[model samples]
Target: MYKGYFGLKESPFSIAPNPRFLFMSERHKEALAHLSYGLGETGGFALLTGEVGTGKTTISRRLMEQLPENTQAAFILNPTLSSQELLATICDELKIRYRKTGATLKTLTDKIYEKLNKNHQAKLNTLLIIDEAQHLAPEVLEQLRLLTNLETDTKKLLQVILIGQPELKQLLQRRDLRQLAQRITARYHLLPLTKGEVGHYIQHRLSVAQCDRMLFERAAVAEIHRISQGIPRIINLLCERSLTNAYCSNNALVTKKIVLLSAQEALGDEYQATFWWQHKAVKALAASAVFAVIVSSSYFLGQLYGENISEKSALNITAPAVNQVVSDTSSPAIIVADNEKIPDENAAKAITDNTAKVFKIESDGDKKRAVEQRIVKTDKPASIPMPVENSAEQLSNLADSKLAEDKATSKVKEKLSVKAVDGVSDDLLALFQSAIDDTEQDPQFKNSANQVVTPEVNAPALSDMPAWVQSDLPSLSFEQHIYTSEGESWVKVNGRDRYQGDTISEELVLNYIYAQKVILTFKGQQFSLPALSSW
Candidate 1:
């Protein structure tokens, strides 16, 4: 269709086995020489094989043209016939008459042998060529071998040449076919074109078609080499498609871009990545896809685990030195827990509300000075009531017993450890309880043993937690959760450790568990964080 527009006498890239357009390369010449040696002088059998679309038939055609004028050739395109059918086909090819009905294998073979003898007597070389010889049954090939066995003192009466794909060589390797394999005098296997020859091949075809100009760019030629892998048939296909593309666009020549688009159109998506994977855009696209998946997956998992806090859901309360519950104000407050305490409340962590009074105590000449400051970060207000008399001394005493407080922290954590793991750490609890004994006796403290609770955990959100979560969250005591990788629920909380099902004291009001490092408030004043001095 594009021949007229491209100044070509015919389509340059037609895949037809037209001998007129054959461009014999060194490989083809070598294969031709091998077939000539086997079949030219005195042939019993000559074998030629190649990969599909590698031009095995083209070489065979050239071989036929080079044969002597006295040669009588019978060519069979399909070799799938049975022994009797094969003999019948040979008789038909040489115009030998046979019985129309009830023809036996012996009857057909005798007729073919008579024809060969007559041709031999007349000084005519009888040649038999079979295409797709790989599909020939063993018995059929054996029958042909037997026919060629009828020889004169000098040469065989019948000369045979087999043209097929690579499987023909493998078929000859069978032990059952050893006699036929040994009788074959010459074999040639044709491979694909090389990169340099590919360019020459294209130019040869175009020149044969009478196109005088350079049709494919140098880069386009390189791309065709890479895509077609030097296979003549595939090269013809890609080139034809590329030319059609150029014709459609009314371009005088083919470019790398046009060839690429043609490859995509002809080969589809399977070949798209094959070429572009070496380019930077493909790598960048792959990297961007991975990053997007990681970010999206993290967010999705967080929605399932509720481990990290987003700004929309909770305030930014920095990781703190210690977890102190403020109960003096009506509003409840929680301060982020840390391994150690920092004297600077601003850098350490934020207090819940503006009215939450934080008293800072530092070593004085001989006494401790208590400096009062209001630090607020959330709408909820959590205040700690202080005794007006010797307030700094009371806090000083609390500060003095650091080892004791750590012990108490550990003790409370054990009693509250997810009991669902089905065990408790008694020794650690005893040690921690002993540590907090002195601070628990301070008169300013109003917390009863039953009033303490931790925030909600292991759920998508605090507001969505079960009713039991509020009561079961860790209390004034320290809390440690043992997470397992097995079973339906991995979190082991106190109690039967059923998810969100822990039991707390009746005196304590169970509220939604809030894990905000900063202050968080529910419907009313129910949460509070006591300053370290107050604790």
Candidate 2:
């Protein structure tokens, strides 16, 4: 519902593991790098462990998509089966044909070895990736270790990658699994994103959805981050429900109220405290109230002047003295009132006087300097004659005060600007303006620039377009030049490439670009399938 209202092409906050929406934080990137190392020419077992929903699976899928042309990969998502069943699954994934009726362990091992050797001879490397390996029995794990032993003098014939939750680390710590653990050449544990990363993660998803970044309020983002603890899966869950609540209400943008409702519903009773405490607006209000009280009280005590107040009356309020001043001979002395029958206000003023006395009393070098400055300033009465030839001093004081006032005003303006721009964008604001105009206009035929353009193109508009355009056509923007088959082809993005390719169509070039960039995932699995690129 909100997608239509907000002009989003898809639900950006869906909880499903969609590779297209994967965003690898710094920690997730390190995990990917470790897995990639294992899959490289220098080969061995690569171990990755993390909490559930931390994106290991997505990372694994991304790595699979990035595998070289001469590399074959098999993924086993479940590893809890018996040794024979596990072996059979691996064989199936590897496309190794074997008679199942009398398939003994020895026979299966031989077949796997034969297949690996054949692949090796064919100049191809094979990678076996096992997920949820924490559930693998010791026997099954031992068998997996044995597979790694199949090797030539040059390098191992097979590369194995094991991924699982943190429990997998404990599982590996078992004495029986020591040998297996020692064989792991590369290991990394994917950590949940930091609080700062959670904000970026939300924006990344919103950008992918093509929605207004302001879809989530600042308070809502904080609530989601606190409750999710920066875990990608949890963030997905909270964001999805929050969006759904907004959708049901037909609201284009998510607000703090909607987030609260969604949190109460989706997180149940577990995250009540976090949901409340992490609200940014609530925090700001609390801080503001505290600051207001402090400033008001400090101002009331630090400055005083009145029309009909006697010295005794002046001494009755908690206001600083206008005439009494400190001297250089002052020590750290406690002030005592001679009259115990003083008025209540006067008693309060005495307390303030005690504080001032304490301020004047110097106990050390820095304190002495500060106290001297205070004495010098407070000693001058407002009625005192202006010193001869002191105009420059007065001007300097005025300039400093004005500069302070300017800085404070600038800070307030900056804060207001930041709040306004928090998650808002020009495009979104224009779209909202157009929506309001359409609402006001009867015909709803507003031809504003904010209108969403349909993806389909009219054939007439492309009548002059060439069939075999140059690879570097103005319409195509790609880093490198590449060639593709005559039929439709897609660009595959990986990473930044300074080099260029030649003789490529726009569509093929796009596919290459997409393929080169890796998608984010959980536990090395692709979080979302990529959208098919337009040809």
Candidate 3:
């Protein structure tokens, strides 16, 4: 309804988990890094704990997006079944076939071991990630612990990642579960967005939704942070409601008053309107008619910045029932699109808002071009023309003959009587001369005759810059180490070579490791790091 008014392609504040709208704060990045390391590193269990809607599932999808080709990962969203059933789920996820459907626990374990062993033999790493794992019974948890027992002399064969809410930490604290807790090698807690992060989160989603205009001002974001307590899910709910109210009221911006109205609609009658009315400071707002705005604003502001603490009784449980199939193995090999998005309520709303559902919206020329450009995947290389030696040569000769004829006719009619240099045709001379001045004046040109005629590099070729010059990066002196911080001495790049052993400097190592040269190594076997510099 307000598409034309605010000039948004879609509703920006929907609460859905669209990967395109994912704004990784410092904390979220750390959490993702921990999870990535846990799976990549050959070690014991990796545990991830976060409150409900704190983006655990989102992180899981992101991890899947980043997982290496050789690493076979099974994400179990529900783990409430018996030990045998759990084993079956893992097998199903890994697509490993087992003969015995009614196999005993020991027999099932043996099958899983055999499958994992086979996979390892094939040079494939298996990672079992169990989400919402707090609901796993003590026996089931112990069963998982037993699975990690299979190992080679150097490192463990099966790596497991257990993710759940904070209650998972509490559950692990039990005396009986202490043994399970001891094996966790890497652990990270995912916290809610900070006040600043909340504001960013809102804007990030809005921009992603194709909105250029600011829907929420600074004051409104602060109000949202207070009410939602910086929880992404709550923030989403409030924002969605606010947008709905704004759309209905024909408001261009989601003002502080609008956010409060949305909050009251979401929070219900328990919140005191009189409390806001009594507060002289809040009542002095420019918008007076929206009475609930002042009261709810104060109430939530108190909640923000630790003025009011959330209930400790609010337990976060990883119910086996929270089953979401984040990745479908059958889905086009699950390409993580440069602009790919995970289905979230926010994205869903954006879709609905942009489509001919709520309003009849017509796109302009730029909008149509933007949409067309998005359809083109520039990140991916152009398709290779299949090799046909005979056909290629014949076509090339035909083109050359035609070019020669055109040049001969042009030379006969041209004003310049000079013959084409070195059998180069007049067309070729004109084409080269058109841009010759630019290259002649280039400062990088060593000498006119010795000018480096660099091969026309494609996007894919230029993308390998870092990998080519990785070894050339400045190295740190031995004494300069000073143990700034402990980082993984080795990283498994593209699962081909494990760059292990401590570098004199982590920064220097990382800079080289993430270079385009190194990244292009994984682009395909068509090109490798060694061949990158030769170009």
lDDT of each: 0.67, 0.63, 0.61
What TM-score goes with each of the models?
0.53, 0.52, 0.51
- Which tens-of-lDDT digit does each residue in 1-535 have in candidate 2? 6677667899887766677888978787888888888776667789998777888888888888888899988899888899999889989999999998989999999999999999999999999999998899989999999988988876888999999976677688899989988888899977667656888898899899986556787878876765675678888878888887888888767787887788778878776554455454476457556756887776576443222233435445333334444444545432223322222221112234323322333358555432311212233223422332355786799899978756764543343231235578786455434433333242211223233221111111212334433222333222222221221122322212211121233322221111112122222222112322111
Q: Any idea how many clashes model 3 has?
A: 11
Model 2 CA RMSD to the hidden true structure, in angstroms: 22.5
**In candidate 3, what are the lDDT values of residues 1-535, reduced to their tens digit?**
5556667777665556666667799888999899877765466788898777778878877888888899888989887888888988887888877775567777778878998899889998889989889888888988898998988877778998888977687688789878878888889977677777887888888888788666887888988876665678888888888887888988777888998888889868743343565443354333333534666776588556232122321333221211122343332222222233422221112222212111223359656311111011123323322223345686799899978756754543342223467867777566434433343243332223343321111223333555644454332111101010111112322111223221223332321221112212222212223222332
List the lowest-lDDT window of 10 residues for candidate 2. Answer: 453-462
Which lDDT tens digits does candidate 1 get at residues 206-235? 999998888999999988987776789888
Q: lDDT for model 1, please.
A: 0.67
C-alpha RMSD values across all candidates: 27.2, 22.5, 37.2
TM-score of 2: 0.52
Candidate 1 worst ten-residue window by lDDT: 484-493
| Candidate 2 Cα errors over 4 Å, as ranges | 273-535
- 2 or 3, which is superior by lDDT? 2
lDDT sort, best first: 1, 2, 3
